[model samples]
Target: MSVPPRLSMATLPSAAGAGMRAPRIDPAALDIGIVHLGIGAFHRAHQAVYTEDALAAAGESDWGICGVTQRSAHVRDQLVPQDGLYTVLQRGTGAREPRLVGSVRQVLATTEDDVVARLADPAVRVVTLTVTEKGYRLDRHGEPDLRDAGVRADLAGHAGAGHRPRTVVGTLVSALARRRAGHGRGLSLVSCDNLPGNGSVLRKLVTGFCAALPAPGGEDLAAWVAREVSFPSTVVDRMVPTTRSGDRDEIARTFGVTDAAVVVAEPFRQWVVQDDFAAGRPAWDRAGALLTADVTPYEAVKLRLLNAAHSLLAYTGALAGHETIAAAVADPELAAAAAALMVHDASPTLRPPAGLELSGYCDAVLRRFANPALGHRTLQVAADGSLKLPIRVLGTVRDRLAAGTEPTWAALAVAAWMVLLVRGRTDDDRVLAVEDPMLGHLRTQLGRLCDRPRPHDAARIVAVLLGVTEIFGDDLPAHPVFRDLLTAHVARLLTPTPRRPSRSAGS
Candidate 1:
C-alpha cells in the first residue's frame, strides 16, 4: 500500500487565491454524497477513516463527506485552508504516527442560514450524525424534547424562513420535508452516538417534531419518513481524546504543514452497524465494519460492558483524583473494582452476539482503557451524566432486579454518583471546570440530604435521584432492594477506604 502524497496546507487552492499556494485536492476524484452533522474530532478520526478505507477498497469516489458545523466555523476555516486534507495522528506512547485522510470533500457552516438548500440536493443519499448525545435535546426522561427551547427555535426559524435548522434532528426533518415535497423520497439518517438504540431515538425525535408541526401533509410526511427512510443502529468505538496544543505542533512537524483541525486519537477503532438502509451506504463492511442483520446483541455488549465501565471509571476516577482513563485504569484498586463490577454484575446481564466471546471482549476493553498513550480525560466522559448514566448504568440495575439478583457494583457506582453529586465538585474541582445539565439539580438534591445521617435517608436520596423516569426509563424508586443496595453502596463509597481491598460484593 502506497502512502498518499502529503500536500502542504499553504499550497491549497484557497491559499493560492490569497497570494499563497493553496492546499488542494482534486475534488473531481471524490463525490460528496454523505453529509455529516457534527464536524468534530471523533467523527474525523473514526467515521472519516472508515469511509476513506471503504472508498479506497471499492475504488469508488461517490462516498466523500460534506461536513457541516452548527455554531462555529472553526472546523470550516481550518479545513478549507487545508483543502479538506488533514493529518490523523494515531498516538501511542513514544510513537505518534500520522496519516493523511481525504474523506471530507466540502464543508458548510449550518449557521449560514441557507444551508438547507444543500440538504435538498439530489446527489445526497445519506445524512449521518456524530453530534454528542446532548445534542438530541432529550428530556430528563430520555425522550426527545421537541419543546426544548433550541429545538423549537430552530424549527420555527427554519420552517418559516424556508431554511434548514442546525440541530441534527431538525436538519433531517427539514430535509425530509423538502424531499417529500419534491423528490418524494429521502435519505437514510444514521446516528453514530454512544446511546443505546440511537437510531430509533433519532427516528422518534424527527417523527415527533413532524407530528408536532401545524401543517398539511405532516402525517403523510411522517409516514413517508418512517417507510422510506432507514435509521440504522450503530455502535461506534474510538478514543479520540481532545487534542492538546503540543499535539497540534507535533502534527504540523510530522506532516510538515499546519492544520488547525487535525485530530489525534489512539489506533483502536470499531464500528458495528445494522445493515438496514433505505437508499444504500458506503462499502464500510469491506473496511472491517460488522454489518449484521440485528445489532441488539452487539449493542448490548458495548453499551453494558464497555460504555458502562467507561462511565464508572469516569466518576470513580474523578473522585479518586485520576486525570485520564489510562491513569484511572493504572490504579490497581480502581482497576480491580471496575473489573469486578463488569465480570460480576454487568457482563452477565449482556447477551453477546453469536460467535462473540464476552470474556475476550472485556479483556480487549480493559487493555484499551489502560493504554497509557491515550490521554482520554475523565471529565470528558463524566461531563454528561444526566444524559449518559441512565442508559449506560441503570439498565444493569433494572436487569438485576428482574432476575432477583443483588446489584452490588451497580449500586456502588450509583452511590459514588450520589456522593460525587453531593460534593458538587469533581476530583481537583478547583482546577477544572465541570459542567452537566443536571449539576444544579444534583447540588439541590445533595443539599437536602446533608442533615440526614440514617440509612433510610440515603435510600431516599438515591430513590429521588434515580426516580426521574425519563432518565432512568423506569421507576427506580419502587424497588426496595435496589434502593437499599444503592443506599449501602453510597455509604461505602463515601466511607474512607483505609486498607487493602476486600472481596467485591457481587464478585
Candidate 2:
C-alpha cells in the first residue's frame, strides 16, 4: 500500500481549498500545558475538539496538549507527519462537516523518555486520560493488581532500570515520581473513561502502586501525590467510530489534503466534569463542558441508560443480522427492544441529575444511535464483553432486582451475548471472532459445555456462563430471580424457529 502524502504545517497556507477547515489559532504560538494519555479516535473527536474550542474561546495559547499514546505507535505514526494537526469529520444525516483541531502541540509514544519529562514539567498543570477500562490494570476488586507482571516490575523499581513502563498504572507512577523529584508542582489528573468513579478509582490504583513500591522515598511520593494531585472524574459522551482507510481516503479527496489522523464522529458531544481540579484548568465550560460540583448523577444516567442500551443493541443487533448501529436500531423490533431496555430495565435504577428528563434522554440516545452517517459498527461495540458487561448491563440487573423489579430486557441482552458466544456467528451468518481479554478462557469454558451430553440445553449453557465469576459476580449466579429469568431468555433464544422463505422462492 502506498503512503498518502503528508499533511504538515508547511502545506497549511496553500491547503485551504473548498474542503479544508483550517484552525483559527496559530499552532506555533501555543504552549504545552496539558498532557493527554491515549491519543485515540475518541479523544480526538471528543476532548481534543473541546480543548481546541476552549482555547479559542479563552483566547489563550498556554493550554496546548501533549498527546501520549500508551501502548502503540499507531497514533504517533499518523499524527507526527501531520504536525499534530488533524481533521474531525462530523457526520450526521446531512453532509459531513470537517474541522481542523490544533490543540495537540506534540505527540509522543510511551517509549520516549520525553514522556516522563513532559509529565513532570511545571508548565503541564493537568493530565487527562482516555485509557479504556482494562488500561487501569485493576483487579476484579478494583485495586491495583500488583500480581500483574508489569505492575510488579514497576513497583520493584525496574522503571529506573532503563526499561519503559509497561502499564498505564506503572507509567503514571513513574511520571509522578519524576514530578516529585523535580518541581513537585501540583497537577490535576482527570479520567474521561466510562468507568464509575473513574477519578477515585485511578487515585486508589496510583496510591496503591506507590504504597507497594520497594524503592526509597515511596511513602513520601504517595504523601505528595495525596496532597498535590487531584483526580477529577468526568463523563464524556460521543460516538467516534474507529477510522477506516476509506475515511482517510474520503478526507484526502474532499479536503485536497492527506490527513492520516482524520477521525469521524457524530455531531453530538458532551462533557460533565467534577469541579475538583487542584490546579487551574482550561475554560472547558466556555466550550459547553458542564463543570459540576458532582458528576455522579450525570455519570449514572449515561452509564446505566445510554451505555447499557448501546451494549444491548450491540449484542442483540449483531445477532439480529444488522451490521451498523443505525441499521440495527432501524429495525422496529430491535429499536423497540432497546427502548424497553432503557425505559423499563435501566431507567428505574438511575438517579439522573436534577431537571434532567429521563424519557427525553432516552429518546435522544436512540436518535444518536440511529444516525446512519456515523457508521458505528456493531462488532466494534460488541467486543470486550467480559470487561463491559459488569458495568454496563449487570449493574442495572442487580439494582433492578434489589428494587423488586424484573430486568427482563437486561437479561435478554446478557442471554444474547451467551448465544453469540455459542453460535460464533450473527443471525445473518456473519462470523464473529471473540475479542475479549478472556477470549481464551471463555472458549475453554464454552468448549467444556459443548462436551456435555445436552450441549444445546439453555439451562446448562446459562449456568456455565454465569459461573464465570469474573464477568458475573458469585452472588448474581445464586440469585434465583436473576438466574431463572436469564435462563428463560437464553432458552427462548436457543429454541429453533422456522426459517423464512428465500426471496427467489416460487420464481
Candidate 3:
C-alpha cells in the first residue's frame, strides 16, 4: 500500500516514493463523490481516516469525501488553506502519532444556497452522515419528526422549484426525487451516527421525509429509495477529544504543515457495518472493516455497553463534581459505582457472544475512562442528555420494570440525572443549560417547587418528563418501581455529605 503523496513525508526512506521519501499524491487523482453531512471532529477522525486508508490500500481514488456542514464555515476555512488535507492525531495509552489523511477532496457549507444542487448530482453516489442523534429530528417513538419546523421548512423548500432542502433527511429526499425524475442511479444513505440500528433509523427518516412531500414524483422517489438505496447500520468507536487551540501548533509540528481542522483521537478505532449497499461502496474491507451479515449484535454491544457507560460517567460524574473523564475514574468510589451499574444492571439487557464476558468489558471501559492522557471531558459526554438518556438508561429501566427486577443502577443514573439537571451549576461557577428536550416544562415546575420539599417536587418533575412519550416512549409514571427508585436517588443527591477534616485537623 502506497502512502498518498500529500501525506508522505519527504524526510524518510526511498522506494522512489516510499515512507518519508514519497512525494504527496496528486489531489487530482481523488474523486470527490462522497457527500458527508455533519463535518464534525468525530467524522473526520473516524470515517475520513478509514476512507483514506481504504483508498490507499486498494490503490483506488474514486471515493474522496466532499464534506457538507449544515452550520458555520469553520471547517471549510480550516481545510481550504491546506487544500482539503488534514492531519489525524491518534493518541493511545502509550503512543501518540499523526497521519495525514487526504480522503477529503473538498468541503462545502450547505448554507451556501447552491449546495443542494450539488447534492442532487448523480456523481455523489454515497451520502454519509454524522449529524448527531438530535439531527434526526426524531419523535418519541424514534420516528422522524416531520412536523418539526426545520423539517417542514426544508420539505417546503424542496417543493419550490430551484429551492434546496436543508436538513439531511430533506436533502436526501430531494436528491432521490431528482434522481428518480432524471433517470439517474440511486445513491446509498449511510449513517455513521452512534444510534442503535442507525441504518434502519436513517432509512425510516428518509422514507418519512419522502412521505411528507406532495410532488407526484415523491412516491416514485420513495419506491426508488426502497429498491435502489441501501442503508447499512454500523458500529463505530473512537475517542476523539475536541480540538483545542494548542492543536494547531501540534499539527504543524507533526505534519510540517498547519491544519486548523486537524482532528485528534485515541488510537483505538473500530467499524462493523452490515454488508449491504444499493450502489457500490469503497473497498473498506481492504482497510480492515468488518462487513458483517447483520450488525445488530455488534451495534448493540457498542451502543448499550460502551456508549451507555460513557453517558453514565458523564452525568453521574458531573453531579459528583468531576470535570474530566480521567478525574472521575480516579475516584475508586465512582469507578466501582459505574462498573457495578454496567456489569450488574445494564449488561443483562445485552446478549454478547460466548467468551465475551460483560465483567471483562466493564474492566476495559474503566481503564479507558481513566486514561489521563486522553482528557475526554464529562460535559462533552453529558451534553446531549435529552437524546441520550432514553437509549442509555431508560432501556434498562423499562426491561427491568417489565421483568419485576430491581433496577439499582438505572435508578441511580436517573437520580444523577435530576442532580445534574436541577442545579445547572458547578463548584467553579460554570453554568449548565440542563438542555433536556423537556426543559421548558421542567423550568415552569421548578419555579413553584422551590418552595415545597425538593425531593417530592423533584419526583413529580421527573415523572412528567419521563412520561413524555416523545422522549422516553413509555408512561414511566405508571411504574411505581421507577417512581420510587428515582425518588430515592433524588433524596440521596439533595442530602448534604458529611465533612471531614484534613491531616492538620479541624480548627
Give the best candidate by TM-score. 2
Q: Point out where model 1 deviates above 4 Å.
A: 1-28, 93-96, 140-143, 155-158, 162-166, 426-432, 448-460, 496-507
lDDT of 2 by residue, 1-507 (tens): 555466778777655665587886889899999999998999999988898889899999999999999878889999988899998888886544678888899999986646877887899999999989888888888888867887777777545757677788788888888888787788999999989999999999988888887656778889999999999999999999877788888877766678889899888889999999888999999999999989999998898889988988888777766778887788777789889999999888888788999999999999999887777888788888888888888989998889998899999889888877777675545577656777777768877654322324888888888999978987899988988887888777666555332111011
Q: After superposition, how far is residue 57 of candidate 3 from its true place, in Å?
A: 1.5
Rank candidates, TM-score, best first.
2, 3, 1
User: What value does the lDDT take at residue 156 in candidate 2?
Assistant: 70
Task: Give lDDT: candidate 3, residue 283.
Answer: 80
Tens-digit lDDT track of model 3 for 467-497 = 6666566567677888788877777666656
Q: What's the TM-score of every candidate structure?
A: 0.88, 0.94, 0.90
Best by lDDT: 2
Candidate 2 local distance difference test against the native? 0.83
The per-residue C-alpha lDDT of model 1 at residue 357 equals 88
State candidate 3's TM-score. 0.90
Ranking by lDDT: 2, 1, 3
Q: How far is candidate 3 from the true structure (C-alpha RMSD, Å)?
A: 5.1
Candidates 2 and 3 compared: the better one by lDDT is 2
Tens digits of per-residue lDDT for model 1 on 242-276?
Answer: 88887777644544456677788877788998889
Q: lDDT of each prediction vs. the true structure?
A: 0.74, 0.83, 0.72
